[model samples]
Target: MSNESPLIQSMRTAVAAAPADVPLRLHLAELLLGEGLGEAAVAEAAVALQHAPGDAGARALMMRAMGLPTPADDKAEKAEKPEEPAAPGPSAGFDWAAAENEVAGAVPPRFVTPARAAGPGVGAPEAPLAADGSGDPGDATAWEVDTPGSVTLADVGGMQEIKERLEAAFLAPMRNPELGRLYGKSLRGGLLMYGPPGCGKTFIARAVAGELGASFMSVSINDVLDMWMGNSERNMHEVFETARRQAPCVLFLDEVDALGAKRSRMQHGGMRNTVNQLLTELDGVGGANEGVFVLAATNVPWDVDIALRRPGRLDRTLLVLPPDAPAREAILRYHLRDRPIESVDLGKLVKVTEDLSGADLAHVCESASERALLDSTRTGVVRMINMKDLLGAAKEVRPSTDPWFASARNVAMFANEGGMYDELLAYLKRKRKL
Candidate 1:
């Protein structure tokens, strides 16, 4: 059967006219992925993938379009895309002029892998796919993902208090910047989300920007570091410079500790400076949008530099703890609301999910759905989750926090406050879990 569609033909024309520039090719591939045309997207990625065989960005785009789940095993990617080592000569002896000409004064670009964006619910850029599983230029290239501010506070589960506080700090000012000036402030705040991995910290970061109607720009730790030929450190600076220009913006830095860690702890002399460069940007530089809010997330907050946590810097740390019983119940309800669930005691299930995080809650729900579908064959109809299904599902899963509980508790106590939640200080005094 012919899998080629008309859209694929048009895509080829577009890609034919496409320039070989790295940035433009990336943007075009992203547009294709947004349209759900997988096969074609892979072909576009292959252009760069062929040239820069080791280029993380090119490979990530290709993998995404090809539905290549993960980076083609590191060794496999290298072996597949053979490289020709640079020739040795007078020019090869580390010529500064040659290096300068190669980069042409561009920011030392980092090869950003898409794994960073592969977290649950975060979609990659779009590419077109053919039925026969071939890479083609997409039939169509249109970006239709939920726009900025699409995720409201209501969409978020069980962070009412944090939402309320964040609204006062970020949303309120963003909504009324001029009015904010009347209050003798421009409404600039930095938020650091620390919690167990996969607990929607990154989602919350993106949602916050959308909720605030602020321009959202997400940067990774590796994006801030690259040993490329041009002005690498300056590239880090340019990223923020662009954000500053796009005021009323939210610059989200995920795994922030990777970039903002303490200089003294850094063994690399160059990164010690990179840390400084980042800190300077986080702080105000020439009155750029007091409306700017920097939201950063990290699983391990302890590794972050103390200076970055000072009152004037990335100080406002927000904890997105694992979903509690009520939150998990809510998370289950939120994710399962669209599906059919019969004979399930949500309240009872909530009680049993004492240790579940939001992400864990999602897995549980997915597990229930799969079980119902498989069980439906004999039952003669699609089934919904019940207590037995949920409980059984819960039993099969475990919290990531459990394995590190002992050491985590020790650090939590000595560093954050005697291993007890500050909010639950009074509760723990009467009945301590630690």
Candidate 2:
């Protein structure tokens, strides 16, 4: 905790106080590199590059921090063609090249390749190394599977109702197999989480995986779709098959509405076939899915195929609303944990962000940090993020969920067949949106 010298600490404080100060950030990065803190130096350099991508000093410092040689020609080229000035904001200006190089060694390849490849006249055709499918036998690399994370329901702050519902609908059955069997409760169905965008549906899905101590594989439309005929269906099959192989796995289908949209409304036969393949996989036609748990999430559940919601598939639904007061406070605190913030009235801030989703809360924090950084940069006086900055940002950020709720209102009121969206309806009514 006390390993850093006083000067290093002071530099960190200054950088946090004036995040837009490219020279100061570069200087801090240089100091960290001199102190043998390579990783820390790389992080500082990365931030500096984001603020000023064309800075020669920052670029050289980044190369040194990463233990890479800075070529003379590369430096000359950088000088000749300066990078475009990034957007003016705290979280703007992502330096993709620097970021990729920084994590190139640490992160594994997205797809696995065969060791030996056939000559020019390859057997048939080289398999596509798409993120969704590499077509390698028994290779699950195509669909990134995260190990059981440490984030459990306990880590999800102020969602007591969500935790309890999850326990009753999903977690309890998995936890007590004997009890479930005694009560004729079959673990053959999946849970569908539906709500406005920016809620923590995906996070909750991951938490469910963590609770079950299972591997987590998240699939989205982009991960499944392919231009070639039938490739999409194959990708979907591969995804489920990978989950089956990695028994005790949670296969999370993000944006299920897009993947399983109503077949009647589909203009393409391929998407219909993809949905059919998904249904087959969910039914485990080829192999038993005994230990594979399915969790799907969507913002517009009404658009999902009706057949997918039938019994023994994604039959159960849970509505995830915006963060409550306590949840908002927790989210704000987490976002501000590393920033140079002082005298923040979290309780007051929470009261003002009543309908803000988790993402919106993050934006508020970013905006507040930007204000403080810009103010410091203009006035030449470094300062910590104060309550005024936070409150102003909160006032500026309209709740992003408002539009989602607006669209959902008509659906919840009119098309709630079989009371599928009763939870949503109740929420709208309570909020006086009905």
Candidate 3:
């Protein structure tokens, strides 16, 4: 359906095959700009710049795409000789700062300085900067921490068994410090929620944070890993330090498998060191992690490092499954709440979407609305979403959880070591997956 010429499409395919080829990518960007696709050209040029940050061709193309003057244009202007003896300002050596501002929209600056102005006072203090001319030291301005949200476990739709287990194994001790002290229960451990994708693991983590009246800071691999030597470990340590500073903070580690993958299987020494740093933080090496609560979620718990799950780490494991019947109905209702709908049979829809995850239920609602929109567009008559459209979408979209469970079936059957995957195995057996 694309109206692009065959040559452009072929170049795109070649660029995809060799994404690191900066020249080829620049050529594609030039072609896109010629076709009047300014936005698309900017995107291609930006990607080429990423591959080769110092490439002159990529920078020129990006400037052209953004309708800004390139370095060559600046050079030409300087060579023409000014009429009034070039002002006694900066030297004629390419004003890089001005050029950066010109293409600021297309390429963002790598670092930012706090913008401030001195007040008209005698003793006004100037803003501080780091030794390297960046922001102030110990400034965790990059990481975002959300205040305690209102989404408690009660707001969570269903999965009653999961709730009960969470309350007994995790929340009860933290909620009653006196009882925990009497019972010799240490409030120092973490919980690892493992399940198929899109099963609301991160949502449950946030809800737990809300229940504890704690701030939430979520960290993932991208937030921790750095290409520079020893920086990844430093980043990981900073994440925990920030959580400790904002005590009564829930440090939710999304996709923990990538951050703490099994060290034995890891091929990179940097990654292994990063995992070691994570272990050190969890153990509260330099400072006490008294008010910090750690909650991690992963689709593949088996891939996480063993050191991370040893006694005092993420010892407790919770299996999050797909939405049950009540959950499906709630999810359907929530998604349909704002949409124009007529006679949505929640009970029947729940029955049809038995094993669908929360995300799948959302997709069903979206697909049904899309169908109604398409019909209205074709017939030139507006219509509300009906049961027929909902049913048709449900029939068309197969359960995305199927493939996840298919792989989980083999793991549950063969790799339920230390009874870690007992909950998953039991669910698989009940579902006759084994």
What TM-score fits each model?
0.59, 0.70, 0.68
Ranking 1 against 3 by lDDT, winner: 3
Model 3 — TM-score against the truth? 0.68
Clashing pairs in 2: none
Residue 89 of model 3: what lDDT?
Answer: 66
Q: Rank the candidates by lDDT, best first.
A: 2, 3, 1
After superposing candidate 1, which stretches have Cα over 4 Å from the reference?
1-147, 168-180, 229-232, 337-340, 373-385, 403-405, 416-431
Predicted candidate 2 versus true structure: per-residue lDDT over 249-339, tens digit per residue = 9898988999999999999999999999999998886448888889999988989999999888898889899978767766776677678
- Stretches of candidate 2 off by over 4 Å are 1-141
Q: lDDT per model, in order?
A: 0.63, 0.79, 0.79
Clash count, candidate 1: 21
Give the deviation of candidate 1 from the true structure as CA RMSD: 22.4
Better structure of 1 and 3 per TM-score: 3
Per-model tally of clashing residue pairs? 21, 0, 0
